[model samples]
Target: MYEMDGEEIFVIDGHVHLWDARQENIIHEGGEQFLQCFYDYHTGFTPEEEQWDIDTYRHYGADRMTEDLFGNATADMAIFQPTYLDDFYDEGFNTTEQNAELAEEYPERFVLNGSFDPRDGEEGLRYLEHLKEEYDIPGVKLYTAEWRDDSKGWRLDSDDAFEFLEKCADLGIENINAHKGPTIRPLNRDAFDVKDIDDAASSFPELNFIVNHVGLPRLDDFCWIAAQEPNVYGGLAVASAMTTNRPRKFGEIMGELLYWLGEDRVLFGSDYALWNPDWLVDQVMNAELTDEQRDEYGVELDVETMKKVMGENAAELYDIDIEAKKRQFRDDDITERFDLGTHYGGDAGAAAD
Candidate 1:
């Protein structure tokens, strides 16, 4: 098993989603219920009521589709489980199971993340244990889009959820990636930003808490969180607005993060299904950054850092030795797949080695 060379750096996208095109069983078995509730309660939201619908995920499928979309892609993708439109089961166990199946099948390309909603008490904890024992998932993902402030009965963080996170730390699971985005409430745009995650990191210093999407609209706040909490990490996942509206500016965000936390603390992630793989790769490759900026900011800031951001940090954090996994695939043919330069820049190639 050879280490990925600096030039041949293989990327690992920390966040992506999958739905088996063949698995109609998901919707019939509680998926629809979950979606219905999500739409009714979250997306189709009014001032008094929040609205959300499964229609959000109208387009998504398994790894095969992802692979096809990322033809000759530079980075490897680590797929995570997606959430439903509604909160059918607070524990994202079923989704985790499906993700595990994909990871086990495609160990070379896909890394598994276990998702567990803290709302389900003991059942949620058991699910985390199950993921460790049965699926070998290396990380956990939580979505607080609908989290309610228990005292006021409005949506926000929950004490119960925080307690569950404390337990996750006790379980030897060091990484917890949480999603914060433009989904539900607005005023707290910066309120539940990545900085809010400092609470979890503070309570459980042993745990590595990654604030996903750089807390959506709160870039500065995300940077502050990473700056304050040693254990806290920030991510750039399908941040379409930033990447799309201002690619260079997005690189600047990365630059600031590097200034505060160094290269390794920030990670590369594509909220995949929401954003196409090719478009995201292009954004990163084209984002404005000098060699010094790249070196300082780490992955996605430049070609080399891109590789690290794609996979290395995530692999390190999750303890996934993909080099070892690649060795297991052992391709004697040494076939060169596709030249990744035309789209990515330098002539990057993948060998079946």
Candidate 2:
């Protein structure tokens, strides 16, 4: 948890992944290209001194990930948003099982979300059920633009996709995290279209639709749609990175979101590995809207607003007991491992070695 202005803000990074993008994992050209694209974004936004080498970026294991997220105690909790690109990778990119490695190790500090491919048809539905049964996933991260065989992508409003949404509802899975985009590699406008979300959100009022990256490059459309669909939310994965060198722009985006979706609907994400939560969390915590932007949007990025965006909103979505988790963390395994028990009233703080 981050102590900002003397108030304890329980930080829950809404988006993170334990991925394997090593050369061996890259079975297709797109896999290499996709990881490269992620690297590009990482380097573009990350500070020079903090940047990881290409090799480490390709495959930073579970231990490093654990330290990056919790060793500092800045983030109280995190959610694993898996991006399973089966077609592009040999073993699939960041499958549920892959993320589960870390999530299982630190169950108290992580929420493991699963993935689904509508193209899998009956088999896909079965797999979705399996994920729910095995992992008890409270939500799912979907790449609508993920490649499957020769098909480039699918749409959220499609008949096939609705079937999966129906199953999610039947299974009591409420959070539907869709990767609406700013054009990541192999993800295009047609595949990552923001308009499809309108019909889907309208159709599944029972499910919460969290649009990752706030549909960048189509922020206007996203904001317009989110204004109408109460269940719709914005996840600050790619957008949060902009706060570093593009604070003004980030503030404008936040202002628009607050004006349209209000403070409750926007969530912060480091898109970890792309940007480490340790630093990104602080960057966002200090970000403020410029005077011109404040006048234009009539919204403020105040502590209360950030409290919701950074943790409370996701807590509500995932049904996490923040107080209970905090109490438990007083002596949880992570606390002992990282010597954070004192920070939580157990001992003294020590960085993860």
Candidate 3:
């Protein structure tokens, strides 16, 4: 929990992953390169002391994740977003089945979000139903660029994809978090384009479309689409990390997001394992938009807005009662057992190590 000026903030990391990227999972050289690519993003933005070695980075299991997110990072709850890179890894990377285990062990602390591949067609739709039944998932994370057999990627606007979206609507899975940001190697860059979101958002008015990373490198396009579509939301995963490395750019991005999408439609996420929530949360809590920036973007980053972005927005989306969850956190033995004192400063980075 982050407290400021006598107000306590309930934190929910809207995006997180638990994956198997170990050497054994690597199918070929591209798999190793994919790991290296992620490592580059991790090391480039991460503080020197917080950076993880390759061995630890490849497979940081559930215990470390629990410590990082809930114990040391000030998050009251986290939503697991699965990224199943079946083509790159032998056993597939971070499937819903793996994430569901964590949700099961600590039911109160986590929300399990399943995934779907539109390319799978009718069979895929059946799998989605099975996932919802087996895991009791409330939402799903869609990786439009994930490789499957001969197909390299997919789009939200595709016919089969629309069918899946319709199924989600019918099944009561309303939140659709789409990965429209950075492209892992072997996937075409166009696959990360934000254009498809426009069509999908229009087609699926009942369902919410949260574009992950806010479609970085294409923020303008995302903002344009989000501005026109009431149901389209911006997920602040990669953009939030920019607060550490590129504060000005981060301000600009936040300014634009608030200006276009408003406070209610934006959600916070650390893109965990790639980035830790401790610093991200602390940085966002402490960050302020300059007067010139406010004038330029015609937006403000006030306390209330910050409060909404950190957790309240997500709580509302997931239908989680913040006050109730806070009470549960206070009574949780696991939360009580771990010391959160180190989270005060840069020392939080060492907790992950």
Top candidate on lDDT is 2
Query: Tens digit of lDDT per residue, candidate 1, span 1-353?
Result: 11233354556676776543222444344445444443342222122221112443443445444454345454545557454323333333236665656566565567667766666668977877887778666567776654343421122145777766666666666678877654533344333555457676777788888878777577777777778888878777745225655656676777787688776777777655445455455556556766766776664455566556666778878776766644433331111233333322222324322
Models 1 onward score TM values of 0.71, 0.96, 0.93
Model with the higher lDDT, candidate 1 or 3: 3
Question: What is candidate 1's TM-score against the reference?
Answer: 0.71
lDDT of 3 by residue, 76-137 (tens): 78999998887778887788988876788888889898989988888999999998999888
Candidate 1 scores a C-alpha RMSD against the true structure in Å of 7.8
Q: Which ten residues in a row have the lowest lDDT in candidate 3?
A: 341-350
Clashing pairs in 3: none
Native-to-model Cα distance after best TM-score fit, residue 35 in candidate 3, in Å: 1.3
Winner on lDDT between 2 and 3 is: 2
In order, the Cα lDDT scores of the candidates are 0.57, 0.90, 0.84
Per-candidate count of clashing residue pairs (backbone under 3 Å)? 19, 2, 0
What's the lDDT of the predicted structure labeled candidate 1? 0.57
State the lDDT of candidate 2 residue by residue for 13-70, as single tens digits. 9999889999998888988988988999999999888999999999999999999999
How many clashes does the backbone of model 3 have?
0
